[model samples]
Target: MKINDYLSHEELKRLISALLVVLGFISIAAFFGFTVVPGLRYQAYTTGESQVQAVQGETGWLDPTEYPVMAKEVIPPIDPKTVMTPNPALMARGKALFAQNCATCHGPEGLGDGAAGKGLTPHPRNFTANAGWKNGTKLEDIYKTLDEGIKGSSMVSYNYLPKKDRMALAHVVQSLGAFDHGASDPKALANLEKLFASAGEVIPNRIPVSRAVTVLCREYAEAHPQPTATTLR
Candidate 1:
């Protein structure tokens, strides 16, 4: 028998029914695409971006410049020499700051065993050990690390911190440095002297963190202005 003759009437009927069902689905989809979807898209086009933003503004959309800046703290004067001094008061302040911020990653003792620090690749610094740290353990190096964290690491920039807070944290980190051997290398102390003697300006910590972020953004923009695209001939 020929292929068509071999098929039973029931089989042919079922096949034709399946084809009709598929065609009905396609027709429904095409109708929705041309009509229903267009209606939805039309609603979106009716509102301009500015108009939408205006509505959002009424609903409490605020500009960054308008955000409430926190009250500034009156930070005491500190020079580079004072920074390295083993002041009990400074160490106490640093400890508090570390507990608030650094302890999350660096642990309570600055040992890099914080619960949050766990699972980070290359592991966090063990302040007790001070191994595999990118920045040296000197006062200036710690200050630099606080200002700009180690690149390609879990460390983040703490420059947003008030200058005094950063300095205090640096002192805390420096204090954590415990040499495995007898004494620190002379070269390290020499490096600290070279950097700390004139460690630029020790900015007052009167400004709050919120304001500091804005200031840093402005400074960065000034330093690295984007180049305008040139038209190709």
Candidate 2:
């Protein structure tokens, strides 16, 4: 009121209008300073790259690569006696295979203390022990166990392994025991030799998981084509 008395009404109105203009400018400046400017500065400091496109194949999801077809072939006759002994090469291969496939249940040292066998009913076999093998500790017996697997146990058939590979594994299992693996029955040894000599093995055809997904997706798309604009109408 005193400021108004000092100035005329017209002058006071002009001052108030000028003050509002100053406040508006301050508000706009504050918004840019606190919000817009910081955002721009942060964007300038950013070092992130734009995402790359996903890989696409001929089937729109598969990578283009040649996958081998498993075909039928005659297995060359092998002497059982030759592979029954654990050679250095066979032991190395067996160790690798055991780690890959059997270690979850059989343990690294084949001591039957594997974590996966902790809850099983009849516990995994301890290869270090000379006794209590469901199948005898003979080379042939181990090979038979690998081929047929135990009926009421955690052991499953590894018959999918090649005959040579199974033989190598058998040798390695036998070697784990400190005691002597009793001699293989001569007739059983002869029979095992004959089985390899007489028969051929054929591995089933298979596809990679990625390739299978791609094929399934492609088939699904083909089977259920999308509705066109005209069709929707």
* Regions of model 1 farther than 4 Å from truth: 1-69, 72-77, 180-233
TM-score for each prediction?
A: 0.47, 0.58
Best by lDDT: 2
- Whole-model lDDT for model 2 versus the true structure? 0.61
For residues 117-231, write the lDDT of model 1, one tens digit per residue.
6766667788778566677766666777877777766575665554555666777877776764234456764655455454443322233223544565566556644333331
> In model 1, how large is the Cα lDDT of residue 79?
59
lDDT of 2 at 222: 64
Q: Output the TM-score of candidate 2.
A: 0.58
Superpose all Cα atoms of candidate 1 onto the true structure and report the RMSD in Å to 1 decimal: 20.4
lDDT of candidate 2 over 80-111, digit per residue (tens) = 56565667776776666665555656777899
- Name every residue pair that clashes in candidate 2: none
Error of 2 at 39 (Å): 56
